[model samples]
Target: MSGQQPGRAGNPQVFQPLAADDPTTVAGYRLAAKLGAGGMGKVYLSYTPGGRPVAIKVIRPEFGEDPEFRRRFAQEVQSAQRVQGLFTAPVIDADTDGAQPWLATAYVPGPSLADAVVAHGALPVEAVLLLIAGMAEALHVIHGAGIVHRDLKPSNVLLAADGPRVIDFGIAYAADATSLTGSGVTIGTPSFMAPEQAAGRKVTPATDIFALGQVAAYAATGTPAFGEGTSHGVLYRIVHEQPDLSGVPERLTELVTRCLAKDPEARPTIAEVIRLCQTANAETVLRRPEDWLPSSVAADITVRAAAPAPVQTPPPPAAAPAVAYSPTAPVAPATPPPGFGPPQQQPVQPPVQRPGTPVPPAQQPPRPYPAPPAHAHAYAPTPFPAHQHQQQHPQPYPGAPVPPKSGGKRGVFIALAAAVIFTVAGSATAYVLQKDDGQQKQGSGGSAQGAEQGKGNDTTAAGGAAAGSAKPNAKADPKPADFKAINLTAGYHLTLGDDDVRPQQGEDGGYELSYDTGGYLDAETSEGNLVLLDPGQEGSLAVCRAETRFAKNIYLTKLAKGRQICVSTGTGHMGLVTVQGFSPEGSPSEYMTLDVTVWRNAVGTGSGSRS
Candidate 1:
């Protein structure tokens, strides 16, 4: 083992690039070079001698310390093998019980959502709508299989030239399984998590919807829903506060707003989201993205060939082709022996191809050979059967659920914690609510009656307003010619509960801001700009005060990273508002406020109370 350097730049051993000759084979496929690295592991550009390419992921050393993590990792690998979708990066190979466990999937060529936003700023409204619809469709398939991609954020979304594809199901959830991150800590990125997930409660499809909303916010404003902040601060806001959507495009604001709803139940289903996005026409998507092609093809026909062919019963020895090698030919799996607790999983062996055959078109780039049939490997129950192939521990095949090891300390602790929390939290709330029901109902009813009367008065007032506008100078306030000319600068403070970064000031004196809100707040600016966040529970409003007239519009677009800062028009008047508080579950952004607008008339000007 090499000695490590603490934090110096020239730590010879830190992130050294892999040499061409370095052994990087997985299953029978050889790794050609290193692609990139992240928190969990290093990603390699691997290919079979036949030329098929794959992106292989190798787990990092730190994660290996926890046995529980390893177990969960192995399970996730198996589950990934079961996923089948054109938009999904399907698993091609894996070896969970090897010295250094590794998994491989067909390589995808595209920019991540984060990279796209950084390079191109926000996408056009139409493109954003397509992105949302495509992503929602992808999630529909994944969630249906009973898997929850606990970490769905911009980085995880790959915007291929053709369309969007989701990657990294390393910590995905199965239909009936506990999350890899148990109680006492959060797992997925803080910004993209649903409110309940932040509270360490159970997560479901609604949680995914919340994450999608954050993605959409990024599309609109080049930011997340909760705004940029420390992971802790972002989580705090997601669980307790609302998002600020001042600049989101009117077409996508509603869709993105729904995605950011705090109550998971209130969020739309993935399929519904897809439909809404398609109909929104927020912006037009470009052409379909590129697709993968088989690595090798016959020179004359251009026909595709399989990476390596599947195993078949051997016939006469004389029938063997020159390239043919027996399974017992003794090729070692890539990587060295382990020094850790248990051995990592082994990679699958590459299949043997038939001589002179053209590669199948389906075996192209994004597409690889179909996954190994269930139980293709003989090392299920026991991870490493290398030195001795034990017979008694016959393991179930891949796709078959692995039983939880009985009585693991971590499992016991989790179960106990869950029991205690549920009993107290559930019982206490039920008891209190039931006891207060009678008095609460009476008060609630009275409030409802009063609210109705107030609505009637507002309607009457609106009618009078319309009539007044018809006749000039009827004592009604005149709409200003333009928004107040406030000279804008760089620093402006806008906060949701407690976020650190604030909004930037525009050269024109106006400020652009955005926030993620699960509930609506009829916020009145001291200067007369009225902004609404998540109106009616899951809605968005774009408010801007240009001159003396205030303008607003209801927004309706699914969460995508390209629809923020759209102008407010059509609904009432005309003004521009930029998105404000953007945050995701795992990686939320910081909140920013600008000098935009203020409502002239509202009953309460002091207390931050709800209407």
Candidate 2:
């Protein structure tokens, strides 16, 4: 592939002009231009007080509106600040409490590995080796601080003149913290995900090792180890099939294979990965050459590094007087630079009036100008003039009476008659509805009283028919025996030892239940008390009770919302838990909300029916 391309003789294609809606300054740093935007937010180019370039990622406004996201974002920023590796972009500053959360990292002025690989073909074997070594070292330092670079794709690795720099830990969470995965969301790229991660299992430092293998393979072959297609298909292949490392260099095949092992434990550790690279380089310390990257990649990096500094526009003088404009005077429009001017518009002409007619009052300007079109391209130029003016027009006062139309009296009479008729009809309907509601409430009260009186003898109930009959009613409104809904955050424990099931922060008690980041419901000490029914088997509590085999934990991977779980609590109460839904991914308080129904003293009797 040809690497030679046009240099930055003028403005570089990488640096885009700031749009009108884009903020020119965030916190104290003056934003120079737009670097790029992603799902999380926009990244702007800025400078520190010392004139060092930095990239500021301003989070999207919607995310800032969520208090849970703000908390997690602050935690991630703190963890990122602790990353002090040579080959990683360190977070130098952040403001998580601001209206728009943002964090700044030392800018690495170079093309990303994905960009370089796309521009030029796969790198030489030696370059790939060096790349792997640097990344391995970066991960070593990151994992040491109890962090996992969860999303370690090629695009996150920037190739600098010195070496590769890992960046963008936006999704990275603490190793011991809860996994960010939730229903309908995947934390990492499918092609780079370890088997466990793709299967919704627990993620550890070894997960990053699997990603490192994928990155190395992609860098050597210009394609992912798992061929790309739909995300589901790719994830399936990552979990169930071997990687396609045919095009990868022969020297790196064995090491890449080990790294891409299906079992996380089978993959080499980060330190071992570094040692493997050294061994590949003839059993000596791997040192970077002057031209560690291929010639074309090196030239691209040089162009990016040598890009001229952006020109800073001085703020407008505070004391300048507003310029006045006369309607009768003709003025020349100022010329704007190419690709940076507003669309042309035809001038509006004044209406001619009779000689005896009085002049109309001057109009007021519109309250707010229309927002920029949603379809406008990111690179579309906005109007850039020293001053802008709006023609003002008079506005009618609020609540002013509108002129009557023809047959106004007839229309008013019809409206009044319709309103009176509707009012009478509504009152009559309310009276009838209230009467019916009172009757239904009386019937329900009788049923509740009967149930309370018979509670002592109702413990010995059985059969699937009774449970199935009550299942439909449970969806409408849970019965009196149902426990209050419980919300269990990841890494927290839930105990059914008491009459009320409540979530505990830690697994300090010998409880029958706890949730894990892997989407599993586990019974820490009370094994064999929890049973997960098949999809269609959920309606029958008898089947749950008769189940001879029980697992210590049940995986919720791919489990439908509102699915039910059966558990015999430590207090000899049989309960049915209906999972409502999981909290949004990346939420600081990621939790699973469950509605539970309990049958007191019904565990060993096989007598607990939903009814």
lDDT of 1 by residue, 1-611 (tens): 00011112112221234666445455665555555555456676655454445667776555555566668777877777887775677777877777666788765544556655665577777677767777777786676666777778776776653467777754544211343235433335777777887787997777778988888888888877787788889989998888877768888888988888788788988767876776686323323322211112011011111112222334766653466332223232222211111222222222223344544432211111123335433211222222022122222442333234422333333333332332232222222222222222333233233233235444422322222222111112223232322222223322222222233332222222223232211112223233332111121121222122332222223222112232222222222333322222233433222223322221111122111
Q: Each candidate's lDDT (Cα)? A: 0.47, 0.63
Span of ten consecutive residues with least summed lDDT in model 1: 297-306
> Which 10 consecutive positions of candidate 2 have the poorest summed lDDT?
1-10
Q: What are the clashing pairs of model 2?
A: 363-392, 363-393, 363-394, 364-392, 364-393, 364-394, 365-392
For candidate 1, what is the TM-score?
0.43
- The regions of model 1 sitting more than 4 angstroms off are 1-23, 170-187, 282-611
What is candidate 2's TM-score against the reference? 0.49
Listed in order, each prediction's TM-score against the native is 0.43, 0.49
